[model samples]
Target: MSDNVYQKLMRVQSKLKAPKNQFNKFGNYSYRSCEDILEGLKPLLKEVGAILVINDEVVNIANRFYIKATASFISIDDGEKIISSELAREEEERVKFDLAQLTGSVSSYARKYALNGLFAIDDTKDSDSTNKHDKDNITSLNNENKWTNPKLTDNQIKRLYAIAHSKGVVAEKVKSQVEKQLNKKVEELTKAEYDKVCEAYENIKVANS
Candidate 1:
């Protein structure tokens, strides 16, 4: 397949420079945050006629909460896209941090790494490192995941029901939503599908007590 879009992405990857501009006081190291990656990507995206989107979701992997960040770079012309995902585990205990603060911190780190994978920004190296960028010698290729996605775990479904119940929603209504949006029973939904419904439920925006 002639992927001109992939070439455009390579162009962005070779040129998009995200320097570690922020200093970490406690760690005594300079690191770039998610905001820094976005600022660097915005102009290059415009230059290549592409758009980048990053989304975060809370997921349980191995009974621990993780922030799953998925980043996509898409060509405006053909909708061809390159996608990358990175997961950051939430701290088991965060001192002086509320639930929201802890989640936000993990989400930022995950998002930054997701963008890094998409744009080939290596944070391990110093801001100024040798290795002439891959502008001239670029090859086009396709990227994807071939594994069959697993269905939602039992705990996830229960959580969904728990959300609806807490929201004053009826069991029948929850069942109806599962069948209507998914066209199948909740038991048949995949993890990604479950996240779709879970995100929808979460979007309801509960008022903080």
Candidate 2:
């Protein structure tokens, strides 16, 4: 049987190499940004006669906000395509505090995961691991030491604890893990760092469950 566009896309998905080029100070780990994934796909897509498009929507799930992102893979050969959808939660508090930042953050997260699904990438870590939001790179990923980087608020810390307790993990463990890894106090951690703390708890949950 001759290879079709769908099979070509599957081959590209299996071969795509989107490296984790970005670094996270909080977790001391590296992760692939949405941009990194897209950049890596360009030449491969061109080779495979395929194109990738990602779309995002702010949708509600369980009365909470989520970014529903869809990644479409289309082949120039016969126009056959594959689509994948992923959702990333948006914190209501962050939405109220800074809708622009929160939206961009969650959108990138969703889009990254969607693309990951379409391309068969394994992402063991969350978006918080990299702080890589394309639209707000300055506010989140780059300026960890800039005085303008705001620390996690009291409410945000409390929220972390609440989530920890709900998940049957000690809230203090989350804070301590972040603080130890980042070498900063919880109050001194930036908003991005707070997300890393949340990711830590998520890891614990996954490990135990």
Candidate 3:
């Protein structure tokens, strides 16, 4: 689509306001948390045929660390919000090296206490999938023996994709090579290994395709 179409949609979205009761308790902010805003906006975006994505980065703060949260909205609208990462960074900086705050938004120092409320799904669940995995563990697209835990998060999937391609061959080709090297096919491998093999192949295909 053209940029003009996108701009027009955003203009319409800007005029759409949140409900009068949209405020959150305790925080005393008239505006909703980013998560809450997204929750409410999701259905509208879908109805209007659009998508939203977020990008985050860390900024140096007087020798300390802070995060910048950018919410990108696409579809019929295109406005964004950038909240202070101070709280998120403070909360994360205090964490010890070994503990896992799986669902916390370290940048905003926001923790997911309960699964209820408007933004619950986006809070803890989303962050967990983004920050918890190592990049090197990704299996190749064709490697049939690489095993992955079923509960891996979305970030893990992306990391796996990166790992699969880092070796110059697609994950599938690498997986196929491994199978050929071992003289066994994916079916010959155990169920535990079956998914791994497929993942390796998928990664390769994703990278090469």
lDDT, candidates in the order shown: 0.65, 0.66, 0.39
RMSD in Å for all candidates: 17.8, 13.2, 18.2
Worst 10 contiguous positions by lDDT, candidate 3? 134-143
Most TM-score-accurate candidate? 2
Compose the digit string of candidate 3's lDDT tens values, residues 1-209: 53443553454355443332334232232332445554566666566555655555655645655444444444444443211211123321222333344223342222211111212233333332223321112111111323332243443444444565764656566557657866765334433344464465555533355
* Per-model TM-score versus the true fold: 0.56, 0.59, 0.32
Full-model lDDT, candidate 1: 0.65
Which prediction has more favorable lDDT, 1 or 2? 2
Question: Where is the poorest 10-residue window by lDDT in model 2?
Answer: 138-147
Best by lDDT: 2
Q: Is candidate 2 or candidate 3 better by lDDT?
A: 2
For candidate 1, the clash count comes to: 0
